[model samples]
Target: MLTNVATVIWDGLNPFEFGAACEAFGLDRSNDGHENIPVPAFAVCSPTPGAVRTSMGFSIEAPHDLGRVAEADLIVIPAMGHTTPETLPDGVAEVLWAGYDRGARLLTLCSGAFALGAAGLLDGHECTTHWMYTDKLQRLHPEAKVIPEVLYVDAGQIVTSAGTAAGLDASLHIWRQEYGAAVAAQIARRMVVPPLRDGGQAQFIDRAVVEPDTETFGSLLEWIVENLHEELDVPTLARRSLMSPRTFARRFRAETGATPHAWITGQRVLRAEQLLERSDRSVEWIAAETGFGNAATLRHHFTRVRGLSPQAYRKRFAC
Candidate 1:
């Protein structure tokens, strides 16, 4: 039902985030066997309807003014240079509130969540922003629950995402929900990006820097990823790492921001998703291949992680 989309542009906007919105909603891909799907009427709107300067020292012009948002079924706020609540442009908050109050979904990419917070729209909702700004967003809006490590948080009518490329993940999530995984995959194919990604922003966060000469566990992590089908419990991994089980667990958590089991399971699920999408294999085969032991166990884990059964995922996304 998301047939109309509008993106709001402001001065000093980040071009990458703005382009993410446009790539997700603005392109007309009807020629790609997607005629059954509704092509959203997309527009770019500005506060004053003129050339808007970007953070990269360039300017881009939007075709419409703030009024365009009033007619959209969804409104997108791209990340801008000024993320603080006190620096919002005139009437931007009102426009966001009006669109949300009228039953339209509001999406923010990265620091754009700050604008939503400034509008008081995120006060009681779960939201997120770029990791660099997560602390500031929470400090500015104590009432909002800020989840810093996820790709995006979908809180009913308001959707917020983490930094940069996570915007694509969030946008594909919306597409998958509105249409289906097939449509999202098709769009992703056109964009030359993965249709689905596992885990969260925590994987991208920088860990404590070790000295260049210090011995690390990089090879162990790579081996785990390459052999997700094997048994990789804490004791086995600890033995492989040449450390005590307790010490290995502590060090893994510190370096990865996720426990060993959680990281391994996430990688298995990611592999299962790829297999489900790319091959015509049975659930039982995929379960065993991904180290889930059996179909029921795979279903339990897949459902808990992806909110969809393995069969349903294959049906929606199989190539």
Candidate 2:
């Protein structure tokens, strides 16, 4: 139901995610497997339409004025490369607040969530931002529940993503909601990122949480990674730690923000990635060593989770 979309441009913007927002909705993709679809028009609206210096020291022009949001369906506030949300230009917050009041969906990429928070739209809502800014975001917006461990958070009308690359994930997710899974998947294929990540952003963080007293979990996580080729299940892991399965499951989720099975799957996928990129291992042997049982199993999960085969990943990363 998006008729028009807009992105707020300002100084020090991260061009990658800002440009990604435009590419996701601005570019005409009708010829790219989307039939009878009118490409959503995108415009860069700023407090003033002129050249603004980016954090990279390069300048780009914003051609439209911020008042254009009145006719827009969605508005994107892109993260600044070297700026904090508190440094937003005067009147920018008022413009964004007006847009939100007019029923426009407020969206942000990475640290862009701060702009939304400043606008008071993220209050009492679940949102996410780049993992590096997780602590800062939570501290800045105490009213908002910052779900730092996820790729993105979709609060119906409002959506936010973590980090720069994760903006693609948020964009595709929006496409999925507006269109369908098939369209989202197709767009992801066109862009060449995983259509969907299997686990949350937590899976990408350091799995071993630091505990003052209980160091068993950290040792167990290390053991699990080293023994990826072995059959290490929850029951077996719990037995090794001398804790009951139920106790282990609860503690693990609290510590890792994911279940035992999900954690293992992520580690296995990561292992496969390492082998693919760093070694000259065949998919069959890689699967066996990465604990996927066989090449077919490896292919199934790798392609499903990563949206790229092991060979393709190697080809891309090995270079």
Candidate 3:
């Protein structure tokens, strides 16, 4: 049902993020054998409708203005340099509000979430920006729940993603929702990217270890990741850390921003994803290897976390 798409550009645009929106929705792939699925009519619009300089020192012309957003079913806002709520252009906030009021979905990439926050669209929503700006975003929009760890947050009408390449993840999620996994997979194949990524921005965060001080917990985390096939309950992990269960649980949450059980489950799921993508193992074998015990348990947690069953995921991502 999503047919009309518009990508809004502005001064200080990041070309890669803007190009992500164009590649996702603007390309005409009707002759690629998926004829029944219709490609959306796409447009690049700017507030000034002229030469817009990018952050990388090049200029690209936008032929349309804010008027194009009015007819769009979805509007994508790419990353811009100035991310403060007060520094947005003159009428960009009004135009965004108008589109939201009329029921158009808004997808923002990286710092573009700042524009939505400035327009008050992110007032009560769970949103995100690039990891580097998440603190500033939270500081600026105190009302918005800014989660810096995830690739994207889908708050119904407003979808926000982290840095440049994560825009592809969010865009493919939209396609997977509107169409199905097959269509999304085909598009991802054409783009030479994975249809689903396992973990989140937590995997990309820089965690420096300062010898014996940080080595205890950091080493424990690495051990858990390596030995996901073992029994990794809180008590076992606590014993391994030489702390009481109660103390270990609190310290684990403080260190990882997640409970021990949640962290272990996430690691198990990530291991399962790697096995599914690389090997020809059966689901039951993979479940046991990842410490899920059985196929049903694996299916339950995998479907809840990845939005697809093990078989379906293997069918799409297996090499």
Candidate 4:
């Protein structure tokens, strides 16, 4: 349903993330070889029709103004690097509130969540921010329930993402809900990023079953991810972690919030989804590589988790 999007900009915006928003929603594809593709498109900038400086010591100019947001389908707020809590300019909050009241979708990227919080849009909403600012957002807005573990939280009309790259995942999720997985996948493919990153997965971090003081589970988790093709059960995983099965399961759940079986199945399903969309391999081949043992097992679990057969998913999301 989103045919247009608007990005709000300010003096100290993070250019990379601001550009990510533009890249996802603002880019014109009329003649970019996607001439026949239905792009979920376009941006209208904030307050002015000129350039804005970024936190990265660079600048980008907008071709439009905040009025553009008034008429758009969605409005995006990207992170601003302003140093003081009270430094936000006069009327910025009003602009945001006005947009939301007018029934436009309001989304915030990372620290940009603060702006939404300030306007009371996030009040009583389950939301998240860059980990570093989770406490700050909470301290600043007591009514907002801040969730730290999620990559993004979609409270229907109000969406907020954790940090820089997480904005990609959030944007794609919106695309999926509005346009379907096919459009989301196509947009992701054009960006050369993963089509789907579950909001529940831990952000890029180590997953080793180690104590807080000396554990280095990141590398170990990477090894597990790479070797997902091997048969892995609790006993085998416990052996690798040098713990008893019960102890390992307890610790793994504590660390990842998922039981070992759930984690493995989720990862395998995620891998299968990627393969289904990105490769021409047979179900048997993908099943073997993703540790589902055989095509039948893969099909069963894939359909169970995704509510679609592998062929159906491929037909919808694959190029």
Q: Kindly report which residue stretches of model 1 are placed more than 4 angstroms away from their true locations once superposed.
A: 29-39, 83-86, 180-199, 202-230, 235-258, 267-290, 293-299, 308-319
lDDT of 2 by residue, 60-126 (tens): 8899888887778888888864344568777788878888787888788888898888767788999
Candidate 3 residue-wise lDDT, 1-319, digit = tens: 6899998888899999988998999888878876755689999999899999999999989999998889998999999874565678777888899889998899998889998998889999999988888999999899999999988999988999998778999999888667655677778888999786545665456653212234559889888888888999989988999999999988776565577888788778767877887789999999999999999999999898777898988887665
Q: Model 3, residue 40: displacement in angstroms? A: 0.2
Candidate 4, after superposition: displacement of residue 258 in Å? Answer: 5.8
Worst 10 residues of 4 by lDDT: 205-214
For residues 1-319, write the lDDT of model 1, one tens digit per residue: 7899999988989999999999999888888777755689999999888899999999999889998899998999999854565778888888998999899999999898988998889999999998888999999999999998888999989999998888998999888767656677779998998777555777566742232221467788779878888999999999998899999988787666578888888778877877888888899999999999999999999888777899987877676
Q: At residue 28, what lDDT does model 2 achieve?
A: 78
Pick the TM-score winner: 1
The digit string of per-residue lDDT tens for model 4 on 86-174 reads 76666667777787777778888888898788777888999988877788888888999999878888886799998887899899878
- Local distance difference test, each candidate: 0.85, 0.78, 0.85, 0.77
Model 3 TM-score is 0.69
Candidates in order, TM-scores: namely 0.74, 0.65, 0.69, 0.68
lDDT of model 3, residue 27: 88
Q: State candidate 2's TM-score.
A: 0.65
lDDT of 2: 0.78
